[model samples]
Target: MPDPELPVITLEELGVLRAVHVRGTDSVEVELTPTYTGCPAIEAMSTDIERVLREHGMRKVSVHTVLSPAWSTDDISAEGRRKLREFGIAPPRVRQASGPKEPVAVELGPTRTSRPVAGPPELAPVPDPVCCPHCGSADTELLSRFSSTACKALRRCLACREPFDHFKEL
Candidate 1:
Protein backbone atom coordinates (compact mmCIF):
# COMPACT_ATOMS: atom_id res chain seq x y z
CA MET A 1 0.00 0.00 0.00
CA PRO A 2 1.08 3.58 -0.50
CA ASP A 3 2.41 5.65 2.37
CA PRO A 4 0.31 8.68 3.19
CA GLU A 5 3.28 10.75 4.34
CA LEU A 6 5.85 10.07 1.68
CA PRO A 7 3.74 9.23 -1.33
CA VAL A 8 6.77 8.30 -3.43
CA ILE A 9 7.55 5.41 -1.09
CA THR A 10 5.26 2.48 -0.37
CA LEU A 11 4.39 1.46 3.17
CA GLU A 12 6.62 -1.59 2.75
CA GLU A 13 9.44 0.67 1.61
CA LEU A 14 8.90 2.79 4.70
CA GLY A 15 8.99 -0.35 6.86
CA VAL A 16 5.77 0.49 8.67
CA LEU A 17 3.54 -2.13 7.07
CA ARG A 18 4.10 -4.99 9.46
CA ALA A 19 1.94 -7.86 8.22
CA VAL A 20 -0.90 -8.81 5.92
CA HIS A 21 -3.19 -11.74 6.72
CA VAL A 22 -5.89 -13.00 4.44
CA ARG A 23 -8.86 -14.23 6.45
CA GLY A 24 -10.73 -15.48 3.40
CA THR A 25 -11.28 -14.78 -0.29
CA ASP A 26 -12.80 -11.39 0.45
CA SER A 27 -11.39 -10.54 3.85
CA VAL A 28 -7.96 -9.19 4.75
CA GLU A 29 -6.24 -7.83 7.81
CA VAL A 30 -3.19 -5.58 7.91
CA GLU A 31 -0.89 -4.67 10.74
CA LEU A 32 0.97 -1.36 10.88
CA THR A 33 3.35 0.37 13.23
CA PRO A 34 3.52 4.12 13.22
CA THR A 35 6.86 5.86 12.96
CA TYR A 36 5.99 7.96 15.96
CA THR A 37 3.23 8.09 18.54
CA GLY A 38 0.34 10.31 17.45
CA CYS A 39 1.76 10.75 14.00
CA PRO A 40 -0.84 12.67 11.98
CA ALA A 41 -0.39 10.52 8.90
CA ILE A 42 -1.43 7.34 10.69
CA GLU A 43 -5.20 7.82 10.27
CA ALA A 44 -4.69 8.87 6.69
CA MET A 45 -2.61 5.78 6.08
CA SER A 46 -5.29 3.55 7.54
CA THR A 47 -7.99 5.13 5.47
CA ASP A 48 -5.88 4.84 2.34
CA ILE A 49 -5.17 1.16 2.99
CA GLU A 50 -8.84 0.37 3.50
CA ARG A 51 -9.82 2.36 0.43
CA VAL A 52 -7.23 0.60 -1.68
CA LEU A 53 -8.39 -2.83 -0.56
CA ARG A 54 -12.06 -2.04 -1.12
CA GLU A 55 -11.32 -0.75 -4.59
CA HIS A 56 -9.77 -4.13 -5.31
CA GLY A 57 -13.09 -5.86 -4.28
CA MET A 58 -12.14 -6.85 -0.78
CA ARG A 59 -15.29 -7.17 1.30
CA LYS A 60 -13.79 -6.92 4.75
CA VAL A 61 -10.61 -4.91 5.32
CA SER A 62 -9.19 -4.30 8.74
CA VAL A 63 -6.12 -2.29 9.65
CA HIS A 64 -4.62 -2.86 13.05
CA THR A 65 -2.08 -0.54 14.67
CA VAL A 66 0.45 -2.30 16.80
CA LEU A 67 2.86 -0.49 19.13
CA SER A 68 4.35 -3.23 21.23
CA PRO A 69 7.59 -3.33 19.25
CA ALA A 70 8.48 0.33 19.04
CA TRP A 71 9.45 1.76 15.70
CA SER A 72 13.09 2.68 15.13
CA THR A 73 15.10 4.33 12.42
CA ASP A 74 16.94 1.04 11.99
CA ASP A 75 13.63 -0.51 10.97
CA ILE A 76 13.63 1.58 7.80
CA SER A 77 14.62 -0.41 4.72
CA ALA A 78 17.81 0.42 2.85
CA GLU A 79 15.73 1.33 -0.19
CA GLY A 80 13.73 3.68 1.98
CA ARG A 81 16.88 5.41 3.12
CA ARG A 82 18.02 5.78 -0.46
CA LYS A 83 14.63 7.10 -1.44
CA LEU A 84 14.66 9.64 1.38
CA ARG A 85 18.05 10.88 0.32
CA GLU A 86 16.92 11.08 -3.29
CA PHE A 87 13.95 13.13 -2.15
CA GLY A 88 16.21 15.70 -0.40
CA ILE A 89 15.56 14.27 3.05
CA ALA A 90 18.47 12.81 4.96
CA PRO A 91 17.80 9.40 6.39
CA PRO A 92 18.64 8.69 10.01
CA ARG A 93 22.29 8.13 10.79
CA VAL A 94 23.57 4.78 11.95
CA ARG A 95 23.57 4.87 15.74
CA GLN A 96 26.94 4.62 17.37
CA ALA A 97 27.90 2.82 20.59
CA SER A 98 28.76 6.11 22.25
CA GLY A 99 25.47 6.71 23.99
CA PRO A 100 25.48 8.12 27.50
CA LYS A 101 27.38 5.85 29.83
CA GLU A 102 25.64 4.13 32.68
CA PRO A 103 25.57 5.80 36.03
CA VAL A 104 28.14 5.24 38.79
CA ALA A 105 27.91 5.36 42.52
CA VAL A 106 29.52 8.22 44.48
CA GLU A 107 30.48 8.23 48.13
CA LEU A 108 28.71 10.80 50.29
CA GLY A 109 30.04 12.38 53.46
CA PRO A 110 32.75 9.68 53.78
CA THR A 111 30.04 7.05 54.25
CA ARG A 112 30.75 3.52 53.12
CA THR A 113 27.40 3.30 51.44
CA SER A 114 26.57 5.11 48.21
CA ARG A 115 23.62 5.36 45.91
CA PRO A 116 23.67 5.27 42.10
CA VAL A 117 22.92 8.62 40.54
CA ALA A 118 21.85 9.30 37.00
CA GLY A 119 19.00 10.71 35.04
CA PRO A 120 16.51 8.27 33.66
CA PRO A 121 17.89 6.64 30.53
CA GLU A 122 14.68 7.23 28.64
CA LEU A 123 14.97 10.98 29.14
CA ALA A 124 18.39 11.19 27.58
CA PRO A 125 18.31 12.36 24.01
CA VAL A 126 21.28 11.09 22.08
CA PRO A 127 21.97 13.67 19.45
CA ASP A 128 23.06 12.01 16.24
CA PRO A 129 24.82 14.11 13.67
CA VAL A 130 22.87 14.29 10.44
CA CYS A 131 24.59 14.33 7.09
CA CYS A 132 23.52 16.45 4.17
CA PRO A 133 21.52 14.54 1.61
CA HIS A 134 22.36 16.95 -1.16
CA CYS A 135 26.15 16.78 -0.94
CA GLY A 136 26.62 13.86 1.43
CA SER A 137 28.47 16.13 3.79
CA ALA A 138 28.67 15.61 7.52
CA ASP A 139 29.13 19.33 8.05
CA THR A 140 25.56 20.14 8.73
CA GLU A 141 23.80 22.36 11.28
CA LEU A 142 20.41 21.96 12.84
CA LEU A 143 18.09 24.64 11.60
CA SER A 144 15.26 23.55 13.80
CA ARG A 145 14.39 20.64 16.02
CA PHE A 146 10.98 20.34 14.39
CA SER A 147 10.69 20.18 10.65
CA SER A 148 7.65 19.83 8.47
CA THR A 149 6.60 16.98 10.75
CA ALA A 150 7.41 15.81 14.25
CA CYS A 151 9.34 12.83 12.87
CA LYS A 152 11.81 15.06 11.08
CA ALA A 153 14.20 17.97 11.74
CA LEU A 154 15.40 20.79 9.57
CA ARG A 155 19.08 20.96 8.69
CA ARG A 156 21.38 22.87 6.41
CA CYS A 157 24.56 21.64 4.76
CA LEU A 158 27.64 23.83 4.97
CA ALA A 159 29.13 22.18 1.92
CA CYS A 160 26.21 22.51 -0.45
CA ARG A 161 24.53 25.44 1.28
CA GLU A 162 21.26 23.61 0.81
CA PRO A 163 18.55 23.23 3.44
CA PHE A 164 16.96 19.82 3.81
CA ASP A 165 14.82 17.72 6.11
CA HIS A 166 16.34 14.99 8.26
CA PHE A 167 14.46 11.91 9.36
CA LYS A 168 15.11 11.95 13.09
CA GLU A 169 15.95 8.76 14.91
CA LEU A 170 13.55 7.59 17.59
Candidate 2:
Protein backbone atom coordinates (compact mmCIF):
# COMPACT_ATOMS: atom_id res chain seq x y z
CA MET A 1 0.00 0.00 0.00
CA PRO A 2 1.11 3.59 -0.71
CA ASP A 3 1.79 6.06 2.05
CA PRO A 4 0.13 9.49 1.91
CA GLU A 5 2.69 11.72 3.63
CA LEU A 6 5.47 11.22 1.08
CA PRO A 7 6.02 11.68 -2.63
CA VAL A 8 6.32 8.92 -5.26
CA ILE A 9 9.33 7.82 -7.26
CA THR A 10 9.54 5.67 -10.38
CA LEU A 11 10.97 2.16 -10.07
CA GLU A 12 14.05 3.32 -11.92
CA GLU A 13 14.76 5.66 -9.06
CA LEU A 14 14.50 2.88 -6.52
CA GLY A 15 16.76 0.87 -8.82
CA VAL A 16 15.56 -2.61 -7.76
CA LEU A 17 13.17 -4.26 -5.31
CA ARG A 18 13.98 -7.83 -6.39
CA ALA A 19 11.10 -10.23 -5.94
CA VAL A 20 11.44 -12.57 -2.95
CA HIS A 21 9.94 -16.03 -2.91
CA VAL A 22 10.20 -19.50 -1.42
CA ARG A 23 12.30 -21.94 -3.39
CA GLY A 24 11.50 -25.07 -1.33
CA THR A 25 9.86 -26.11 1.95
CA ASP A 26 11.93 -23.51 3.80
CA SER A 27 13.95 -21.67 1.21
CA VAL A 28 13.49 -18.19 -0.23
CA GLU A 29 14.71 -16.53 -3.42
CA VAL A 30 15.09 -12.89 -4.46
CA GLU A 31 15.93 -10.97 -7.63
CA LEU A 32 17.81 -7.67 -7.89
CA THR A 33 19.44 -5.11 -10.20
CA PRO A 34 22.39 -2.95 -9.20
CA THR A 35 21.80 0.80 -9.22
CA TYR A 36 24.74 1.46 -11.50
CA THR A 37 25.51 -2.05 -12.73
CA GLY A 38 28.12 -2.59 -9.97
CA CYS A 39 26.56 -1.36 -6.79
CA PRO A 40 28.74 -2.07 -3.75
CA ALA A 41 25.77 -2.62 -1.45
CA ILE A 42 24.45 -5.71 -3.25
CA GLU A 43 26.38 -8.15 -1.11
CA ALA A 44 25.45 -6.51 2.16
CA MET A 45 21.83 -6.02 1.18
CA SER A 46 21.55 -9.61 -0.02
CA THR A 47 23.00 -10.89 3.20
CA ASP A 48 20.68 -8.79 5.34
CA ILE A 49 17.55 -9.87 3.45
CA GLU A 50 18.57 -13.51 3.48
CA ARG A 51 19.38 -13.46 7.16
CA VAL A 52 16.07 -11.87 8.03
CA LEU A 53 14.19 -14.42 5.97
CA ARG A 54 16.10 -17.32 7.54
CA GLU A 55 15.39 -16.06 11.05
CA HIS A 56 11.71 -16.20 10.09
CA GLY A 57 12.14 -19.98 9.58
CA MET A 58 13.19 -20.11 5.94
CA ARG A 59 15.89 -22.77 5.49
CA LYS A 60 17.47 -21.25 2.43
CA VAL A 61 17.43 -18.02 0.48
CA SER A 62 18.71 -17.40 -3.02
CA VAL A 63 19.16 -14.22 -5.03
CA HIS A 64 18.55 -13.93 -8.74
CA THR A 65 19.41 -10.98 -11.00
CA VAL A 66 17.09 -9.47 -13.58
CA LEU A 67 18.15 -6.72 -15.96
CA SER A 68 15.42 -6.40 -18.58
CA PRO A 69 12.85 -4.03 -17.08
CA ALA A 70 15.79 -1.98 -15.74
CA TRP A 71 14.61 -0.47 -12.47
CA SER A 72 13.02 2.98 -12.32
CA THR A 73 12.12 5.52 -9.62
CA ASP A 74 8.47 4.89 -10.51
CA ASP A 75 8.50 1.69 -8.45
CA ILE A 76 9.40 3.39 -5.17
CA SER A 77 6.56 3.04 -2.70
CA ALA A 78 5.23 6.16 -1.04
CA GLU A 79 6.48 4.84 2.29
CA GLY A 80 9.91 4.50 0.73
CA ARG A 81 9.73 8.08 -0.38
CA ARG A 82 9.05 9.16 3.17
CA LYS A 83 12.08 7.22 4.29
CA LEU A 84 14.21 8.94 1.67
CA ARG A 85 13.09 12.43 2.60
CA GLU A 86 13.49 11.66 6.28
CA PHE A 87 17.00 10.55 5.45
CA GLY A 88 17.65 14.01 3.93
CA ILE A 89 17.45 13.19 0.25
CA ALA A 90 14.70 14.71 -1.86
CA PRO A 91 12.48 12.23 -3.67
CA PRO A 92 12.73 12.01 -7.43
CA ARG A 93 10.39 13.99 -9.61
CA VAL A 94 7.38 12.33 -11.20
CA ARG A 95 7.84 11.50 -14.86
CA GLN A 96 6.16 13.94 -17.26
CA ALA A 97 6.69 14.98 -20.87
CA SER A 98 8.29 18.38 -21.40
CA GLY A 99 6.13 18.86 -24.55
CA PRO A 100 6.74 17.87 -28.12
CA LYS A 101 9.80 19.11 -29.97
CA GLU A 102 11.75 18.34 -33.11
CA PRO A 103 14.65 15.92 -32.94
CA VAL A 104 18.07 17.22 -33.95
CA ALA A 105 19.84 15.60 -36.84
CA VAL A 106 23.59 14.88 -36.92
CA GLU A 107 24.09 16.58 -40.28
CA LEU A 108 25.23 20.17 -39.83
CA GLY A 109 23.52 21.52 -42.95
CA PRO A 110 20.78 24.15 -42.59
CA THR A 111 17.87 21.72 -42.71
CA ARG A 112 15.84 23.06 -39.80
CA THR A 113 14.36 26.44 -38.88
CA SER A 114 16.18 29.33 -37.17
CA ARG A 115 17.82 28.14 -33.95
CA PRO A 116 21.28 28.01 -32.43
CA VAL A 117 23.23 24.72 -32.62
CA ALA A 118 22.24 22.41 -29.84
CA GLY A 119 24.77 21.36 -27.21
CA PRO A 120 25.78 17.85 -26.21
CA PRO A 121 23.32 15.50 -24.55
CA GLU A 122 22.62 16.24 -20.92
CA LEU A 123 24.34 13.72 -18.65
CA ALA A 124 22.14 14.28 -15.63
CA PRO A 125 18.38 14.38 -15.47
CA VAL A 126 16.64 17.73 -15.16
CA PRO A 127 16.67 19.19 -11.65
CA ASP A 128 13.65 18.47 -9.49
CA PRO A 129 11.12 21.13 -8.58
CA VAL A 130 12.90 20.99 -5.26
CA CYS A 131 11.93 22.84 -2.13
CA CYS A 132 14.34 23.54 0.69
CA PRO A 133 14.11 21.02 3.49
CA HIS A 134 15.27 23.54 6.04
CA CYS A 135 13.26 26.67 5.14
CA GLY A 136 10.79 25.44 2.53
CA SER A 137 12.14 27.62 -0.23
CA ALA A 138 11.49 27.01 -3.94
CA ASP A 139 14.66 28.80 -5.07
CA THR A 140 17.50 26.33 -5.39
CA GLU A 141 20.72 25.69 -7.28
CA LEU A 142 22.64 22.53 -8.10
CA LEU A 143 25.94 22.43 -6.25
CA SER A 144 27.22 19.16 -7.55
CA ARG A 145 26.02 16.39 -9.78
CA PHE A 146 27.47 13.79 -7.43
CA SER A 147 27.29 13.69 -3.69
CA SER A 148 29.18 11.58 -1.13
CA THR A 149 27.14 8.69 -2.49
CA ALA A 150 26.54 7.66 -6.07
CA CYS A 151 22.74 7.91 -5.84
CA LYS A 152 22.53 11.46 -4.57
CA ALA A 153 23.43 14.99 -5.71
CA LEU A 154 24.29 18.10 -3.71
CA ARG A 155 22.12 21.20 -3.98
CA ARG A 156 21.53 24.48 -2.22
CA CYS A 157 18.39 26.54 -1.88
CA LEU A 158 18.81 30.16 -2.84
CA ALA A 159 16.04 31.38 -0.56
CA CYS A 160 17.15 29.64 2.62
CA ARG A 161 20.78 29.33 1.65
CA GLU A 162 20.78 25.77 2.93
CA PRO A 163 22.55 22.88 1.30
CA PHE A 164 20.86 19.53 0.76
CA ASP A 165 21.09 16.28 -1.10
CA HIS A 166 18.66 15.32 -3.84
CA PHE A 167 17.95 11.75 -4.89
CA LYS A 168 18.64 11.73 -8.60
CA GLU A 169 16.15 10.09 -10.98
CA LEU A 170 17.48 6.99 -12.63
Which segments of model 2 are wrong by more than 4 Å?
Answer: 1-15, 96-128
**Candidate 2 weakest lDDT stretch, 10 residues:** 1-10
Query: Which predicted model would earn the best lDDT?
Result: 1
Candidate 1 regions with alpha-carbon error over 4 angstroms: 96-128
* Candidate 2 positional error at 59, Å: 1.3
C-alpha root-mean-square deviation, each candidate: 9.6, 8.8
What lDDT does the true structure give each of the candidates? 0.79, 0.61
The candidate that wins on TM-score is 1
Following a full C-alpha superposition, what root-mean-square deviation does model 1 have from the true structure? 9.6
Give the per-residue lDDT digits (tens) of candidate 2, residues 44-145. Answer: 656766777778898878877677566555556566667677666776665544443333224233421222345544643333467666776767777877
What's the distance in Å from true for residue 147, model 2? 0.4
